[model samples]
Target: MRQIDPAFTGQPTNSKAHKAVDPAPTRWQYRMERLWLTPMFRAMIRTGIPSFGFVFLFTWYINDPVRIAAMIDWYEGAVSAVQDRPEFMVSLLRIEGASEDLQDDIQEALPIDLPLSQFRLDMGELRSLLVDLDPVLDAEVRVKSGGVLLLRVTERTPAVAWSYDDGIEILDATGQRVATLSDIESAGGLPLIAGEGAEKNVPEALTLIAAASPINDRLIGLARIGNRRWDVVLTGDQRIALPEDAPAAALDRALAMNAAKDVLARDVRVVDLRLPGRPILRLSQPARAELKRLQDLERLSLVNTEGTQ
Candidate 1:
């Protein structure tokens, strides 16, 4: 008996060409396949204890002393290249100091034949300092044989400094402490501010004075008082007391008073504007004679007016 053709019987025949065409993966499936194929993950072993052991042994043997030394040397050379960059020099004017110390420290920390793994840049602390000095730093760290570590860096330039109990700490505009001043000599002519909260308040005072410009130009130094108020020392050795609260207004009032009274010429030692109602003044001893002379002139004028009437 002849077999019936299924196609003719209204039952479709199954053919290789007619099967669901799944030629290539969907975009999602392709991404999923690639995700597990990452170099780190792909290198991991899925099966066999011996295979894993063999891989571990091979890597351990290959990373032995001589190869590690070579890697360390290569990294050291890279570090030298980084340090030699002109931008690095500009960013870190004190690079010579930090690098000089770092060189001695690194040599002591690692031996010549030591691997990169033995060396460390102390980067967590050092990196932020460098970055704060210059934000453009592109430092990278690597370790080699016997623990030899290397640092490749780009550094930054320092602007302002903060005076803390620990010492004067250099900082940029962002207030990140960069480096500590060594002694009075190393600190040079940079503005010196003292007191517990001087670092925080001094900057704000400077900013406010800067905003006031030529009016506040006579200000020579600022002192933080009672950890709450600010007192200004003018160039003429005159002291101006500012209230803890209304410093700006007090400063403006001082400027206006200076213009009107010429109090500095009158030999006033202290101008206390801390109280708004009454301005307190301390007259210098030398001005006592002048004060008496002015009073005598006023009394003579009053007598002459009464005599004429």
Candidate 2:
């Protein structure tokens, strides 16, 4: 038999014996390696990395207000640049249903510079400004194709001329002030109203004037008596006192009587129709003198006839 070496016999040899192989891994290390190879572990790793990255990014974003504001400004600027393009610009304004002077006033009141983008104009604010004008009763604004802004306006119509302490003012049917006039003559053919609270009853006064159409040309103006009733002033300084309850009806009756009896044509200072059933006439100085003279002549003639009998 051949002699066996000690190394082969499980004894250490002088030459570096084959290094003892590392012992099998520890239990914890073995378990870790096994767990790392599992599908669940891989999934957890994938999900946790993204979650951690998100947390860090979110925290950084919340801590910086200046950065957020800068981002917002950048977004607004980008959007504005897109909207302010030449195709979206409003270059001309077209106004309709306004007089020449009113058109000039509207142009002066507009808050926009020419050639501005529609996106920069606030339609609501522009509408409010237009409606605030004294002459503008109603208004409409629209953006048309071809970069034109269309403004349609409805102006107030003067229904009556009011005489105030300052001057004469033209009023619409609703008692709204339309414009100031130099005098009553400047009001054209509109009826005149005077005294406080007369403007509030313009519609009623106009109705009464309409009822007195037969004598309207001779009717001068209407005065609000004690702010309750109306006194219809006619030419030659004649006044017709009207009842407060139904002045229009009273005026119509007086006009009808005048048409039949020529009462208004007579030399009367005042025709008082204030009482319900009683009508009083205040004659002018010449009319009163002529009546007294006729009465004396009749009495003298009657005495002479009695003496002859």
Task: For residues 103-192, write the lDDT of model 1, one tens digit per residue.
Answer: 454334432332212223344655444344323234554443333345555443454455656776755444445457776457554444
lDDT of 2 by residue, 7-125 (tens): 78997776575455678998999999999999988887889778989999988986799988888999999998998998999999999999998899999999889798898888888
User: Against the hidden reference, what TM-scores do the models get?
Assistant: 0.46, 0.75
lDDT of 1 at 225: 76
Quote the positional error of residue 281 for candidate 1 in Å.
4.1
Error of 2 at 219 (Å): 1.6
- Which candidate number maximizes TM-score? 2
Which window of 10 residues has the lowest lDDT sum in candidate 2?
12-21
Tell me the lDDT of model 2 at 8: 85
Alpha-carbon RMSD, candidate 1: 16.5
Each prediction's RMSD to truth: 16.5, 7.1
Q: Give the C-alpha miss distance for residue 211 in model 1, angstroms.
A: 4.1
